[model samples]
Target: MNALKINTFIGRQYDSNFPEVITDAVPITNPLAVDKAYNILEENEGDYLYGFVSLIYNDVVIFGEEQLTECLLDTWSTFSYLLESRYDGSKHHIIFLDNYPYINTTIQENGQYYEIQLDQYQCFLVPIEPFKKELKKEFFNFVEFCKNEKLWFSEESSYRGLLETYNEIKISK
Candidate 1:
């Protein structure tokens, strides 16, 4: 899974390594004020600060729901219009962590090179409500609309799995 690359600094000042695709970035500070992002994040587990940007595939992942509340909240302060202007269901996404998660890219400055190490893998989808009933409700509603509208639902179409799952969910309910 190739994640959107975000340039992070180990000791504050970010470099120009930021990917052109990721237009939004955190505040340029020696130590990012992750404390300020608290309202969006679950309270800090301890004394640590870090920042992140994500390109989530969708609300649902191989893992679970793309917990975007914090990322969405931070964009209000940091990116301002990035999310609202460009929230394509599968491309733009965000997540928050109290600590640094990925290894910073190393670069040669002047004549010297440095490596900014991150503590965690930096590419994990934060674990949120895996079985969100609200999202499921929306999905089922879409499926119902499809059934009503007969969207690609002919005998030759591939809705057998969908019908089977719908039947299972119906029976369980």
Candidate 2:
């Protein structure tokens, strides 16, 4: 297999030179998709943590291999619309997913092409409020830490930094 670097799914051209962490981490399961992030979201339902986000280039995700069964079953229209509206002349767009956050990418090996899926929940670097209400302690702490630490990014940083921080927090915990 070609050595695709295993790091946060920042935009295609992103290199992690800034402070970031990962949260709501989990292991991937689905053979056809990355279900790790979804597993965490499901387990944390009624709690504070939520789903993962993918840093996409245009409509195509740059992470790993997976079937868009969930996306098609769930947010096909929303994603399509997002592509149509937000894709523009830009070659990339970061998708902020509150739920159903998973991806699959293709690989070549042994004279054949294959797909490997990973749970993207391991991709998020911060805890997010599950509901649109006052922030919880963990959420507040993570946000405050981001602010004080100057971890926030202006252009493509939000997606990458938040996802990176999520991983850091997960490892520390």
Candidate 3:
């Protein structure tokens, strides 16, 4: 069995010469940090919710950073494409991150599994069903979080489109 996990964090924007400086970060899973993180996201609406996301496989961090500045909405939007691709039977997909190093993760379907590669040296095989299950769960949970917080984008048509896509994927084989 392959162990795959996705964790997202909410981070505060800090003044810096470089755009990647985010501080006082906290995981979305942290109950106490939820409101505080939401406040930071609300205040920095123009900045697009500075955040971080990590992909862990079998206890190894495939990609992540404590200070990396990632736009929460955009990252989720990008990841949604993977679900679409998988549903459409696409053999190959690549997810490009929006921050430093500009690393792109590749996912290639091989039979009942996806071979995910972070780089030449880091690769893992995960069964397709579990990957979809975890991704969908996290995506929907984040959407619910945004809705409960009454985030501005939660009402946007684009965000609604994501919810629609998620529903479609959920009912499909």
Candidate 4:
């Protein structure tokens, strides 16, 4: 398969120069995304980190491969929408997961894909069955992170409405 270069996404690189960061001074995830700046004492310190912002998604998500595929197609279809049917754009499905936080590789590298399906709870980077080629994935950067949040549970599609309807369906206990 031809590897496409995708610069846009949740964890896209803002610039070549990364601001100095010291992550997790204390335990537990913070409620908000953290992308702070710090002073680097020496140039060598720069080698240690790939500074980028990743959004915190603190939710109990129960999704399967079908849901994961749906998300992948949604993201890719939305991305390809700009083309207006001129050509077939890449689905840009995530290839592999290495259980890592930083997405510092390119579309041609391993772990590039992002859609992760699960039976329940928490985000993790687990390699799927295909074991295909992967792309570099950055965590949710500031801008993309905010943009994505806007798409969730809008007036046209409220979670409360869905939940209410779902509860109406009586399954015999």
Tell me, by TM-score, which candidate is best: 3
Model 4 weakest 10-residue run by lDDT: 131-140
Task: Summarize candidate 4's per-residue lDDT along 117-158 as a digit string, tens digits.
Answer: 222343433232121211112212222332343323223322
Q: For each candidate, what is the lDDT?
A: 0.29, 0.28, 0.64, 0.25
Off by over 4 Å in 2: 1-101, 104-135, 159-173
Among the numbered candidates, top lDDT falls to 3
lDDT of 3 by residue, 67-153 (tens): 255466666765667777444545443433355344555676779877776565677777778877887778877767766766564
- lDDT-wise, the better of 2 and 3 is 3
Model 2 has an lDDT value of 0.28
Error of 4 at 41 (Å): 8.3
| Residue clash pairs of candidate 4 | 10-141, 94-113, 103-137, 112-135, 112-136
lDDT of 4: 0.25
Which has the better TM-score: candidate 1, or candidate 4? 1
Q: In candidate 2, what are the lDDT values of residues 87-149, reduced to their tens digit?
A: 332222223333245322212121122122234333221111111011122333334433454
Badly placed stretches (over 4 Å) of model 3 are 12-15, 18-22, 66-69, 89-97, 154-158, 170-173
Stronger candidate by TM-score (1 vs 3): 3
